[model samples]
Target: MNQSSSQSSNRSLPDSEYYRAFLDRDSNYDGIFFAGVRSTGIFCRPTCSARKPKLENCEFFATAQDALLAGYRPCKRCHPTDHPGSTSPLIKELITLVESDLTRRWKDQDLRARGIDPTTARRQFKSRFGMTFVAYARARRMGEGLKTIRSGERVIDAQIDSGYESGSGFRDAFSKMMGSPPSGNVAHTLKAEWIDTPLGPMIALADESALHLLEFVDRPGLETEILRLRQKHGLAILPGRTPITELLESELASYFRGQLQEFTTPLHLYGSDFQKSVLKILQQIPYGETWTYAQQSEALGNPKAIRAVARANGMNQIPILIPCHRVIGSDGKLTGYSGGLARKEWLLDLEKRRKS
Candidate 1:
């Protein structure tokens, strides 16, 4: 199966695609990839069949041995460590050192000081995890921050415990996931997390009020949208979870599984009244059905607002749930979408297939 080389980090499965497979426990991908759950600190084959972990808690590795090398223990049920290759003694020792000093930032020079070839370590880690060892270590540190916060520790305490000396760095990192400032006493703040999908990874932001944003990783102007939402709503977006996040994750998994046709997750919309009206028109777009910009404009009682309708569609931060992709050109040609035209096509095709 020449699995090792082919499954290198660059050639690894896309997070979104692999996440769908993992959710389904697809046996075809069993030997091709392993999933590491940050919350449990365990790795499992794709077909593990255990209760699926939250999307934010997952990291993918190309091999079971790599999972072990990255400091995750193999799942007892999946027996990922029982796979073909054995972890080299050197790699095992390296992993041990990494786990022991997870709070300390690691550098290639540190490996060299220990008589290990820095290039070898970098290549091995990159091949397996699609990132350099230093990157993996930093992610581990961030994971620690998540744990501290999840355990009910205050944000400031978690920042120090996660080895951050600067308050701004900790706040920035934490806000991007948790969607609330370390000192925020704000209520109903949406927590944002990334989930891998077949097209690519998508970000989901939610709070007790409603699901706020769901945009693809490659969506154009995504950062702009995030910033605007944060500033306008005074919400801090970080990498944590809430009850709504769990609900959205489950609904999204079912959406991909073809078991869910519509989303019932509550949503917190942010925009001008006109934009809200435009989004409302978009939401009325039925499953497997599409509307043209002109059609939408007329429906909104402003037939002359065709261009405005199109602009609103482009500005939509929420994609599938709002059904922005269902708005096409008057000529029935697919038009501009923040998630890209190709995704628009795929979403339409998926709806069509499921409709039959």
Candidate 2:
């Protein structure tokens, strides 16, 4: 049974064939098998767009455990094992059924007719997706509705397109989620765009020169942030992207690869003056090096302000671009990071490997 399971869920390939796939770095093979490169001694999914290694310089493993057993670890992007566990056959069937009919919302009565327990199904789905099935379905339908409106369709056209018949019902939902009516306007004139990142999705807004907002998909207080932007600018942000989006994506990829030593692109910094000073000091720490809070405070010419430095570091608005991760605790521990300490360690290690 163990052997059969491995073969059925084979996420990796043999060393010889794995090298070929690794050389390609194609998205088609991602999440199947984890590939470990002998050259860098790093394991990654096939879709990792980072620079490919030579055929002979790569190794492969079927599972993350196998990779780690052979002295490799998990890759960040693709989040190989980050998904929820496989559901029961019935839940799988329910998911498949709902997926087939995206135009129509699945209701509890529909599940009862199929002899499925709606409450149990709801719990299982929420356990995996962090939201109830109905919530996700509603979000999906709303996304479709938004797309239709963006394409110059009438409000009623968009509502019907999303499987909703009542315009008022749709209007209430839109206002609750996005804080405005159906129009996805931004700046009364400025543009906004959505780009997928390794961590999650980012909704970025920019002008001709600088990127103003780059919020993560699951950022705490994200809804509050959006409302703040709307009230301050007298406009609404829609899901969209501009030409500079491509530049930001490329540079972020490079930064992940340790190829980028600094972010030269214009950044519209937002934060208190103390936070700004701390962030600037963080940038000067250089790639692959680090500083403690006490060290950072000393550099700021206020040796007694170590706690203030730490607090300021916590509020650094721009993460990777500002390089607040280069600041650790005086105890040499990887300290607080808004993006999580694991990511902080990962970035620091990535930079160190590049210096090597």
Candidate 3:
């Protein structure tokens, strides 16, 4: 088939605009499009380091799946299917350091001692993890302290071991995170962890029984959602992992690789009865297929509840497992997705390609 015939039907922008982005190797367009070279039958990300092709030989696609289905092999030089705007080497190195020593509180001086710039670290960490490196380190330390206290160690000892010298400082930080002083009889806690995917870093929250929340770190209003969860459940969210979170992380890895179609991780959904019903129908959307809001409302036996159905989808705290991205507008155009329209498009394309 010719390049045009094989191109994705969902291309939102003109070919000229995509070509300009490709020529510039713009990181902003990295996940937005793939340039398929007719001459080489190879496709690459917009920020691919490989040499650009002539305009006449190029066709643009909305997603990696689109390019692959269009009969273009992924360019080995860029590994378009592997990494989008490949995670920075600095981010990888710093994360390695933290994982090796979770309880070690990282300070600006410690970063400088390692010849790393504190300002750059903060900016990069904020961009990637949605928090400063120091904040992330502190959360790790607090999580460690929580574990120590749960292990029956004295609260004071846990504080000292966590690198806090002043008693008030330790309690203040601990209380702020756990919603209660370390010495209080805090019986239940929800552990949260950052799970990295090809798309981006996502925050997963869970207790012992079920996964509560999983969302992209960069999603708007994410902080407010977390706060609401904390308030609603009366649980302190610490940076750690539980059985449910670990299961979710593994399932997510497999799902992204297109090896798993259905999610088995248990979930504890929090919502109104109508919202809960709406989410249940969303799960039945069938992998690789989509349903319009009208279809969803009809399924609910209330054809006039389209707006309500859309609102319920917007309020979905756990996205992928609940399959909120499968819903679209009646016009066949994508609707509002809290994870961003690009992600919605990419996810739909993934499911469509894998299903076939």
Candidate 4:
């Protein structure tokens, strides 16, 4: 943080150390520079492009916010700012640069022509975003593609418009995402991960940073909800798993086995605004007690949203962590969950057992 450290930090690290970290997706450097992968047309933090980068091609930057300000975008999984790079003055510049030209593909040659050292750009990006520029760019494109899909555009169109060459190529890109085929192939969609828990094996999903869903298979309404998610996201579930899901397995297992009371891991909550509002209230419910929908609605300041609140509970993507099971009916009956009624009962009883 001193002047010499600042000056040295402005210079790029040797490719050996710089690109290696990008390939590794090391989280310790999330606020570092961004890497833009040429092959994928995405930019990432130094911690991204997990597949590795060649010595000749790796670009370095001192900040992801800078690389992004240089017109690069964020890698989905290697989220730089949501982790803390936002604390820098450079992050604001990156936001403007990328948002201004999201459609333009970034290239190292382009940087060099502009008097920017692409390799040094990698160091800067790695220093901030935790990856090189190209890695971040590719992730940004994928994100736009998902948004396009969510907006009711066709996947093929989303792909072509986003800079990919074909639907197969798009599918391959998505495989790197939610770990599933396109939702059109529901039976084969790999939208979530299933893990063993002390209470029972549970299924969970995420795009990268967010926890999409976490529930017991036997829980009521889970199947239908999964199908709904498929149609909504135009994505299928892939067989891949993320560290968050692994953590979810361990934490929920401990919670159900009656050994833990709090969950601090990150959660991916995807839904409507109402659902999000309901989730915020649910997260505040005490671990040992429960709240009726009437109580929850009252807390949210919308007495009429009680049923809406229940619907949001059913729509919750991160269950136990969000603690939707804590919401009850006016009659004190455990309400609906994408997970089964029986599992809800089991979880409630399990929490009680732990409290006792």
Model 3 scores a TM of 0.54
lDDT by residue for model 2 (205-302), tens: 66556776665433444445556666776655443445565577678768766688877767766667877787788878988899888888999988
Task: Write the residue-wise lDDT of candidate 1 on 36-132 in tens digits.
Answer: 8876768888888799987777877665544543335557676553332434455556656756655566787899999999898777766644656
- Tell me the TM-score of each prediction against the true structure: 0.56, 0.55, 0.54, 0.45
Q: Per-residue error at 142 for model 2, in Å?
A: 11
Write the residue-wise lDDT of candidate 4 on 163-186 in tens digits.
656544444444344444444455
What are the per-model numbers of colliding residue pairs?
17, 7, 0, 78
Score each candidate by Cα lDDT.
0.67, 0.59, 0.72, 0.59
In what order do the candidates fall by TM-score, top score first?
1, 2, 3, 4
lDDT at residue 185 of model 1 (Cα atoms): 57
Model 2 lDDT on a 0 to 1 scale: 0.59
Backbone-clash count (model 4):
78
Note each model's CA RMSD in angstroms. 10.3, 12.3, 14.9, 19.6
The predicted structure with the larger lDDT, 3 or 4, is 3
Model 3 clash pairs?
none
Tell me, by TM-score, which candidate is best.
Answer: 1
lDDT of 1: 0.67
Write one digit per residue (lDDT tens) for candidate 3, span 139-199.
4444343333232344456567545566454444444434553224444577766565656
